[model samples]
Structure formats: structure tokens, C-alpha cells
Target: MSLPDIKEALNEYEFKWKAEQVTIQATLLKEHSDGRVTGDITITTQAKEYHPHIHQSQFNFSAGRTRETLAKTLHSRVPDLISLKQWEDIIEQLCVKIVAMIREGEPALELAIDDTKNIPPEYLLEPILLKGLPTIIYGEKGANKSTLSILFSICMLLPWKDNPLGLVCPTRSIKSLILDWEQDKEIVQYQAKCLKDGMNLPYFDVYYRHCARPLANDLPQIARNISKVGAEVIIIDSLGAACGGELNKPGPALDFFAALRELRIASIILAQTSKDTESKKKTVFGSTYFTYYARSVFELVKADEIDKTSSDIALFNREANYSARHDPIGFHLTYNGTGIMVQRQDVNIGQFIKRHSTQQAIYEVLKRGAMKPKEIAKETGENENAVRVALSRMKAAGKIVMTDQGYGLLSKDIMQ
Candidate 1:
């Protein structure tokens, strides 16, 4: 009815639909008729021309129907004839047409979350963000640790159905520079093959650096190179290859870590935990600084008797100066037709309990002696409600006893 309304309708229609028979060269132009703006749409093909009179309200609807019908019939033939981007454009235009009809009936526009200032760089990052930090994948020998690292690299570069880690979404495009000192050329080729097949994404600038010592002299140079390429993430395959300088001292490692932060890039440094029985520490290698320096650590462990390997993903809180908890989130690895695939496995309750202080305190209280609900709450320094909840769970697990004297932990399961 109005000029603005008609213009809006046409624009919406353009967005919602595409020409069904593109064999018909289509031209849409506006004209004024009896104080009302109308559209004279011309459809010209190989042979004849068809002129269609489209009103403001009906323009979008008709366009959508035409597009839908044509798309269904020409689906198989369109890809062979047009480029992917062109096909995308055609589909997008059709969507616009369908959306135009509904726009008028819809309520006034609502404000959306302003993320223009929030978009990260378009480069891909490997070892995708989990728990707000980059993670290093480490495991025992023969565990396919590198394979897992490659899988992570692929996950970050590819578009997954949901966010793998419960971190922020609509992440900035990331650029990762992988320094694979281990240098298994075959595996690298396999990844490239996966990328070609679209099984994995090759959006990042991938580089293969083969050297005995990736950390000596090469570390800073590598950082500069990735900076030039605008990479936001870097993956150093193994700590052994990447650690040539004095690791015990903070000076060397500190500079390397600082360079990464300066470039606004996160690093995933994979390292192996030594097998010697003399070592008491649980982390990969080095002193507290290794774990201390890293923002997050994911330890991959192999089942002693079982054929499968498990990965425990841990979130390290820098401010707190320790992992909020140490129990690793578990995953099972298997080889699919293409390559190694990882599926999240079961939760480890023992690890889970040790990591949680409240749960530990409750268990401790029940272990010492039997006490009433109120007594147990006081002894555990927990609230009545919390104590009751813990008691219920412990009882369900058969870890605690409901005695006439009070609540007692089953001694057999006390240490467990």
C-alpha cells in the first residue's frame, strides 16, 4: 500500500526466493501505478518472455513457491553447473523470499547481542578452547598421543555440531601453527588427505618443523614466524622435542611462554610423563613450573590391562594457582575407517571425589565415627542440608551406615 511497504516487500522477496528456471533470465523492477508502487517482473529465457505483475504482499510468497519447486527438481543438476558459492547465493536468495512474507506479520525488530567488537581473528586455532584455556594432550608411550593431538587440531579447524568444550561459542576463526618435532610424515599426509576430503578442515596455516631440539633457538623464531602468519594458537608436539634449554630454570621457558602471550596466541605443549618408578609427581615432566605455567592440562592415560586409552581433561585455574579439581574427564579412543576417533567415556568417581573437598570432608567424617545428622554436619564443617545430601549419596553407594548410634562409614570402603 505504501512506498516503504512495497520496497520492503520486494527486498524481502529477493532474500527469500530465486528463479525456479534460471533458464529464464529474470529482471525485477519497480513501477508506480495509481499512487501504489507495483513490481513488473520480467522472466526472459532462451525463447520467450513472461511478464508477471507482483503486488507488495504477494511478491515474496510467489517467489518462494517458485524457488522451492525448482530446487526440488533441479537439486542434482545445480551442483554440476554452478560453483559452490554461486549455489549458496541461489539458496540464500530463495531463503530471503520465504522470509519476506513472514516479516510483515512479525513483531518489531529486537536487539541482538552486539558481537562486532567481540569477533576473534578468522584464523583457526588447534587444541580448541576447553574451560576457557588451551590444553596440552599428554599420555604414556604407544598411546597414540600424537594421533589424539592431530584429532584435536582437526576439531578446532572443522565446524562441529556443538561446542566440544563448554566454552564461549561463535569463537573467532583461529590460526594454528603446529610444530611437529616428532615428524611422522605419513601421519601428516593422512591429515592433509582428511582435509581434502572435508573430513577435517585445513583453514589454518600448518607447518612441519623437523628438528632434534625445537626449543633451542628455534622456539623464538617459530613464534615470530607464526606471528607473521597471524596465528592465534600453536601446537608443540612433544615436550622432549621442544625442551632443549635449561627446563629447571624459569628464564628460558618463561621467555618462550611470554612470546606466545604477547602474540595473543595460546599454546598446547604435549609432554610425556616418565615411566621411572622413582618419580613421585603425577604431571607430565619438569617441576611445578611446567604445570604452573600452563593454563590448562589434559593428561591422557592408558588402561593398564585394557586395550583402550583414556584422556582426563583438567581445567587449571591460573588465579587459584591449582586445578579447581584434578580428576580427568575421560574419553575412549578407537580407529574408525578414516583415522583415530575419540568418544567421551565414563566419569571416574574416585578421581571426582578426591578433587572435591566437600565430598572428601564428608567421607572423612563418616570414616572416623558414627554421628547423628547434626553431629555429622558440625564435624564436617558442612551445613545441615549439605550433610544430609552427602549422607544420602554415601548411603546409596553403601559407603555409609545409618546406625542407632549415628551415621558410620562402611570401613571396608573407607579408603576407597
Candidate 2:
């Protein structure tokens, strides 16, 4: 069988048909007496209509529902058609173009669902300060973990209630969706007003998705539910509340994490940690699943202060600590007239610089191909001084390598 002509994918008259909504397009590669084998496409609202340009055979599709629905349908049809694999290549290209176009045009308002960027670098002093990353703040029943969670939620909702807390940074506009299993919607709202004194600077969209029936125990079922939310970040608040059945069994909790990854949303789950344990090293008390799978973990401990009102927040590293620990990166929780705000304790600029520099250097080297330090510096438009420093550090970190030919990235795992 010959390769299907790309031109056959669209109709010539589609250009004049005002076919702006090509959200669903199917190219019937071969028509059987009863059914047809198709190269399916579903794009963004803008790309919903199919238009066949004479020069461009593959029309760029859009993102979101269109792309997802199309990919699933085509993938499902793969087993039915012998030629499905061949059409898949073309379909793959179309899928990519659609996703890119949608991202550029829509700018993550509705389409950007994945939470890969929320994870902090391993070395950072404050790995838990990520904007979109899901984090769980768990402690002993009376450890005030729930109080802290409530305060965090209020800070996002009414950012302006306190001094620097209300300061609108680039990340302040971030959208957060929380499934408060422990707290009721009314209580969460009351706390928000109390925290912010009715400042009314709406910044977050809070959802009251109380899990009456524990779905976390059923991994597949829970995964399907979360995937439909289209949220970049999610919070369970208290892990045990939603996770039903025996957590120590290792099947349900592990499966829950797996489902979280599939949902492509960053989450924060609260878990309890016992104080009687002599090990200061241990933070969260749960199955190893707490340490595994999580890109970063933090253990908040009470501070030894003259006044009980003051709290000491000790940060921890679980997996990656690209950010250093020496720097004071924390917040001093204080109550104001309306709400609470965490005042900045300190920030580690040096650590941030090193972490970002390494990440950027690795990315640059991978993108520009194998090259020596001098070549890399020149290509990246960085001074030789900066390049040498970065290269030396990268090499020591085992993120890159030197060969007879030139230097190159050590790992191809860098995501595009």
C-alpha cells in the first residue's frame, strides 16, 4: 500500500467554508464496505474547523479537549486498522502542532493541566515554597497542621490582608484548587475572611470537594476523577481523611501516588508525624510512599521561642536538594486584624543562583549540541568567566561530561 497523500486529509473547499472550528476532523485512509479507517484529529476552539491550505497539507490543530479526545480515539482505533501505525506518525505531528499552538494562544488559562514545574530543585533551602507544586502539611493531631493549612489557603485568597503577604509578585496570580476533605466550605471561607479581614483580593479558586466516600483507596477511580478537574495544582489537606483502607498495606497509597502522576497535577497531602520518635531525621509518619514518588518533602516543626505565639519552621529535603540549606528561607506567621501573613525570615540568593545556573547550563549545553566550555560560553552569550564556573560545577555534579570531541549533556532525560 502506498503512503496516503497528506492533501487528502482536508477538503479544498474547506478554506471558504469558514471552517474555523475543526475541533474534530477524521481522514478516512481506507473505506471498507461497512466502516472506515481514519486519521483522527481534534484541536482547540480556534482550530475546530478544518481548512485545507493548498501548500500546507497538515492543518495545525489546537489544544485541550480537542487534542485529548482525538489522541484517545485514534489510539483506540489503532488495534482495528493494520495501517493505523502509519497514520499515527502523521497524527503525532498534528498533535504536537496543536498543543503548541494552543499553549501559545491560550496561555494556560484552561489548557495547561500538568504540574511538572511545581517540584523544587533538590538543593534549595526552601524546596517547599513552590507555587504550583502540591504539598501536604501534616503533623500530630494537635500540632496545628490544619491551622497552618487554613492560613496558607487564606493567604492565597486574600493576599492583601498583610504586609508583604499581599504583595503581588509574578507568582501571586497563580490559580490554586483545593479539595478540602477535612474542612468544610463554610469554615474555610470564615477562616479566609478572618485571615484577611475581608480584604477581598480574590486570588484563588477554592473548591469544596469533600470525599465522603473514600476514593483514594481505589486508585484507578480516584485518578479518573482528579484527571477531569483540569487543575494545575491540587491539595488533599489531610491524607488519611481521603485515603481509605489500610495505608500500611502499601498497595492503595502507592497506587494513589501513581494516579497523581497520571493526573499530571501537583498535589500537597497532609500526613501525621509522631513526636515521640527519637529520630529527628524522620519527618512524615507513613508508608515509604511518602518519601518515594514525592519530588520534594518538608517537615514543619514547632519553634522554641519565649512567646508561644511565635513558631519555628524547620525545612527538610527528601529527594532533590539542588537548593542549599544554610540560607534562611521561611515565614514568621503572625496574626493581623483580619487574617494572618507569613513574614519573610530570609532568602538564600546564593543557593538559588547556583541551582538555576546549573539547570540553565545543562539545558543550554543539551540544546546547543556538544561543545567545549569556550564554545558553550560563546554560543550561550555568556562571558567565558561565567561559563567556566558553570561547566566546572556541572561536571562535578555529573550532569555533563568531557570527551575527546567536546563537552555534552550526560543525560538525555531532560524534558522539552
Candidate number with greatest TM-score: 1
Least accurate 10 contiguous residues by lDDT in model 2 = 8-17
* TM-score against native, each model: 0.46, 0.45
RMSD of 2: 19.0
lDDT of 1 by residue, 66-163 (tens): 54544443444444443444444554453453344433344788878875676533323322343324455555666556655655555555434353
lDDT of 2 by residue, 27-59 (tens): 212222343222223322233232322121223
Top-scoring candidate (lDDT):
1
Q: How accurate is candidate 2 locally (lDDT)?
A: 0.48
User: Alpha-carbon error at 1 in model 2, in Å?
Assistant: 29
